[model samples]
Target: MFRRLEEGDPAVRTLWSQLVEISLQEMFGIFDRLGGVTLDYPKDGEAFYQPYLGEVIAEAKEQGVARQSDGALIIEVPGEETPLLLLKSNGTTTYATRDLAQVRYRAQTFHPAKILYCVANEQALHFRQYHAAARRLGFVPDSLELVHVKFGLMRGAEGKLSTRRGTSIFLQDVMDEAVRRAREVVEAKNPELSDREKTEIAEVVGIGALKYFDLSHDRRHDIVFDWDRMLSLKGDSAPYLQYSYVRAVQILAKVGTVNFPLDKWKGESGRFGVGLPEDVQRLVRELARFPLVLERAAADYTPHTIAQYLNDLAGQFSQFYECYPVLKAEGEDRAIRLAIVAGVANVLRRGLDLLGIKVLERM
Candidate 1:
């Protein structure tokens, strides 16, 4: 395929163009479903860099960074054992060569301070080699940050999924199943809800559950995908967070903002904090950490940090809920409880949004 493309076969070009267009459409469709993902950033595929492949190979050879080894062009990056292949024996460009071209193109065009590859952990070696080669070839300056944001895979009961072996589970299928299961929960828990409400809420809960399960884990460790675990309402899942958020919404709604005046208690968190308002300490403390959590998560590139913080915040709210009686309490006490609920609802909604999970007013 690469050889035919490099040779400029008319038939191959037509088919390749059609395939790339279709594949991109399909890929963007999946990204839409995943949420919190966007392709607005400048990007170019292998086809865009194909024309420069030979130029890159020639330059590599001229710079003495690449050599013909076993009838192929390879770059043996210093301190790395596995050499990066620039061309196959057929003189067709490799993925590494295309990537190197992209590096050069972006470096000259955008002058970006950093280039990050959010690829699977298995490609660690490839990034190391290509990045080293890019630097050696002077494609990028030494100060330009080339980062590999590696994350673990989702394993099934059989073990790690493999697309080559046809053992990979379709993400759409998993999503559909989660939504179906979420619908069932909605029906059982709130049968009186409208049909439209049920469907919308299920989608929010189901997709949220899946996202939460993945993001809640430490990015470096692998996670086992289980329907029960992913959708659990009482556990550290998206549904649990969503449910807690909705529960707070429900409490606020039941009291009716007019009756309790949530606005009156606003900004009174300091007055109602810790020992001042009694048992509200945990929730107040967690709520206070929201800003710091955002800063830390951004600095570390760890979404799970937000996930874990939301999880703990939800748990603290759960404890506060059991200990305090929002609806039963009167006057100052009731307003304080409602204020805490309001604070939790806000943070949970915002934090979940940060993770690309949708929120529901009630579910």
Candidate 2:
């Protein structure tokens, strides 16, 4: 089929174009369902770079970065026993040809400081070779950073989920189940909420729970997919943080504190009251660390850093809430405690947003 398409067969080209259109549309729908971004760029599929394979090979050969190994065109990376194969012995292009073409195209077109590839750990060695090849071929400058952000698999009861093993879980199936379970929990918690409200809240909680379950774990470690633990309101999950945010928001609402600006208590111009209780002080300190946590998370591209910090912050807030009285306190004590709770809610909302999780006003 690919050969027919390459041969300029009209029927094959029409069918291939139709398939690409359908696939892109389906991908957009899925991203919408997940409440994720639909990138604002033209599609750059393999077909777009298919014509560049010859140029990529010719340039690599011209630069002496690529050589033939028993009739297979390959690039030798230092310290690696296996060379990167661009073309097989049968004169057919391998994935390395397409990927290297992509790297070259993106580097020239986008001029990005770093091109990060978020892929499974299995491609680690492939990336190492291609990155070296890109540098050696002068396709990209030494200043251009190529980062391979490798992550582990989504494991199930049968180990790593795979279509061949009949253990693969479709993403839509998981998302639908998450929302269904979330709806049930919502009904149990707040039966008074209208169906529309429950559904809206469920979507937020369900997607947030699913994203957090994966994001909370280290990217290097495989996570056991379990819904019970993921949506547990009191456990280390997105629902836990969402519920905690709702609790804080409810307190502020009950106290008629509609606008609790975090800037009043954060940054260099921030001020605080004297002689706050130990628990309140601890909560304040945790809130203050949000900036540092965000910095580390961004710099390392490790979302677990933010997730872990949010978990710790929620725990400290829980401790403070149980031991203090926000609605019943007086004067300076009441003001400071409300500020702390508001800060907690704010950070939870922001942190969860960073993790692509949404917080609920009520859960």
Candidate 3:
């Protein structure tokens, strides 16, 4: 991809590179604000991997696994009636050939237990053919797993967003629009806040709202982008979670110097003589399950599970906050309730961090 881009006309390539850099800068800025980190590109791997393309194709042809279909080179994969084309009739390489070489290079270099390709569902057959061809050519071992983690499309209001149709929205525009709408909401809700505070809050809310909306949905299902729904505070949205976090912070602030004795609440039934409220217990139980939720999400390679869990945790904490009065309660009761509130805040912050969403101290 980089080679093709670099091989284009100098003026066109420079313009394209500038546009890509601008998009990347905007994207990275948003990510940084949301407490996310960026990864470094593997620059040295290009030299090592580039030579495998021709080698793999030559081996395929030499082994009789790749044959000529008309003027194009093709491989007949098992369980599929149609042959996978490796090269065009014009003697140009196809994506399948490049993919087969890439996969073989990865397997030889990394020897990883599993190689997961997170791609759209539309390219399912392409990956299948690549995997099958690589195995048949002895480039990939049978023991090494090559899995495709297919995701669904993200559509706009009218239909699938396409650049050719001129309906494709740029990342900068989306971020700007979200922040702009968020500023309006913040201004209306908290008119007394200073400009700087409002701007900061708007940024956090806007970016968080956008990220939560994406991560909350099942990856295999198509999601429609709706501004009103994404920025909403009522339903299972980022604003709702932020509001819950703020409520917890407010409760903690009311009880000035109260200490949360986590040691006292080590077990399900703590030393507190009074029985805890059901809502408080529910919040505690949900907080306890965060580790399991994190593990499951990592195993399945789905951040939506973590997003869903955080939303549920936020809802549980909201109910507990509404039902119980922490500052007004006496002695052990107050301590227990404060501990629960602290736990909720901690879990909520950590969960949001996992989803690359920022938390607002005040919203």
Candidate achieving the largest TM-score: 2
All candidates: TM-score: 0.91, 0.93, 0.86
Each prediction's RMSD over C-alphas, in Å, is: 3.2, 2.5, 3.7
Clashing pairs in 2: none
Q: Arrange candidates, best TM-score first.
A: 2, 1, 3
Arrange candidates by lDDT, descending.
2, 1, 3
Compare candidates 1 and 3 on TM-score and give the better one. 1
Per-residue lDDT tens digits of candidate 2, residues 17-64? 898999998888889988757587547478888788889999988888
* Root-mean-square deviation of candidate 3: 3.7
Candidate 1 lDDT (Cα, 0 to 1): 0.84
Which consecutive 10 residues in model 2 have the weakest lDDT in total?
265-274
By lDDT, the better pick of 2 and 3 is 2
Pairs of residues clashing in candidate 1? none
lDDT of 1 by residue, 154-271 (tens): 9988789889878888878888989999999999999999999999999888988888888888887788888898888886899899989888999888866633233343354553
Cα deviation at 21, candidate 2, in Å, is 1.6
Query: In model 2, which regions exceed 4 Å deviation?
Result: 257-274
The alpha-carbon deviation from the true structure for residue 117 of candidate 2, after best TM-score superposition, in angstroms, is: 0.6
Model 3 is weakest, by summed lDDT over 10 consecutive residues, at: 41-50
